[model samples]
Target: LDPASGRWIEDKLPIYDFETLDDFERLKIFEKPLLAALSRKSFIGDVLGKPANERLYGSLAAAAIAVYKGAHIIRTHDVPETSDVVKLSGALRSRTSVVKEGRYEVSVLEVKTPQDAGIAMRNIGATKTGSEVMQEKSIHLVLKIKNLTTTEALIIKQEMLARGGDAALARDAVSHETETTDVLVMGTLLQFGRLARKLDGQARSLPLIAEMIRECISNRTNLEYRYLR
Candidate 1:
């Protein structure tokens, strides 16, 4: 509905497929509250030249989109039907829990972060602390150490490989060309913990580097960005 014109915006109808929820995905970065009122009374019948009672399918489509786009509230004339759509769309949007194939059920788990891994572990009856620690093992991080001496870069790569992780350094580092190289350290939280501990016992700026790595991960885990309207 266009408030300025006091008329319905035909393009806003979900059946027309003009309005999209693409921006809603990016909107999550802002973390603002959203409320959507999607109901059977969207005036879609008028656009289709049909009766009011025949808009059930259009309403269901719109309601599915609302749920998938993170609507806080969904107003609907058909409560039970809309509720089912909400559940299905919400499940698909968040994660695909299960699929059936050849008389076998496959459970699909999405674990991009430690939080996601923790949830997955808990669902399988893991203890809370156990899940927490295991979740860290499930999460891998890559940190770039910039402006490092060739020796430091070589040491970093060797140490990471020793810990079952890996690091990439510039060619200059391997050739000992007296040039500083940036090292990309890749490891799970568990491997990183081991690396940091090992670095702590080493000499010459390695302890400080370990502390810096820990602090970097800590800050990332706790950081939250807020925006004012």
Candidate 2:
């Protein structure tokens, strides 16, 4: 409706126009059973009557439960607090060790025996241990390639998927719905390393793209370990 023209507009329709309580109630019909169950619980309404701090505690508990139940990307007005809850919940749930500092600090060095030297030698192996660790970890990477045909994108995607990783062409590129000329490659460090090696001897622009990917990986690894001061 245009207030300036004093005209009732009919061209655009509201997707969700809840004019009355009845309209809103109709939307909640599907969740009526769950709502009924919650209503039966006195604790639920009791918690709702509390002050902001108490309400926030309740909300944090709900958020933790949701995260434990496999929810990701929780939307919250209290970003910092909710982030702490989620991080704590994830740490409690997952087996992976959470690194407090980005890099470990060597406060003291007690190299008293030959075994300690051997341990150090093992730690500093011939190959880059950092790269090896990155490969072993379930790392995910997204690479965007521009100015590529659908066929070329599919070839890359197929190669990546065959090597236990996954890749995809831009949504429109697959069905030719639109003129999208890009490919998105997803893989771990090892899979990407293998792909780059395979691409090295290939003809045309593949080798170029491969080199670009290698450079990106190298830069990422360098950035990751740059905090080891």
Candidate 3:
């Protein structure tokens, strides 16, 4: 009878606690993610046996699976970067959380051109701040809009500033859209991945971030906007 049983079930599901695991037990559970991937027929290639390569792919596959299966936490030593990546990806429809299963989606409306997208995002107050020119759009806004609403963003900023430490305002934002399903206020596209990996990995403030974002916009081609409002 553990007090945290409820949380354990929700975050680490399928099983709660175990004293020990026999070889068979270990293999069975370990195969779940591989089987999960096999079920999708989404990937096919060389399955190597070397520990280094195999383990690397396994970790990535598991991480992908965890995201696919609605995992709430991930273990990593690079929390800042990882969390930054997570933050950006979750920017899409982040205004709300705790959605029904299979309800995640993003709306993308392709403007007539990249310039059109830039104008639209800037109208909403998004400042271009990225690593390179990922867009010709003057204001390529990448905002996390799912885990929180615009109102929540304001509240969070206020609370954090009031509490001390600038943790609320994002230096950069990204969206976590696996595909198009549940949403509004979008154009017509979806993206997912460790987005921070695309940046220079140096910025950590909002003011300088605006400059970084402009650099980012200057580095891309099909540059568009992830509007905040």
Strongest candidate by TM-score: 1
Candidate 2 per-residue lDDT, tens place, 1-229, comes to: 1011111255522211111111222222122221111111223224357644455665566556545433444555467888898887666654323345667643322232223333444554623554344433345578888887666676688789889888767788777665547777887667888898888887667888899898886764352333222
* Candidate lDDT (C-alpha), each: 0.69, 0.53, 0.32
Residue 91 of model 2 has an lDDT of 66
lDDT of candidate 3 over 12-50, digit per residue (tens): 421221111101122222223211212111121222334
- Tell how far residue 112 is off in model 2, in angstroms: 31
Query: What is the Cα-based TM-score of model 3?
Result: 0.18
Q: 79-136, model 1: which lDDT tens digit per residue? A: 9988899888888777447888898998744345677677767767899999887887
Models ranked on lDDT: 1, 2, 3
Candidate 1: where is the Cα deviation over 4 Å? Answer: 1-100, 103-109, 224-229
Give the runs in model 2 whose Cα sits over 4 Å from its true position.
1-137, 175-180, 223-229
lDDT of residue 50 for candidate 1: 64
Q: What global local distance difference test value does model 1 have?
A: 0.69
TM-score of each: 0.54, 0.38, 0.18
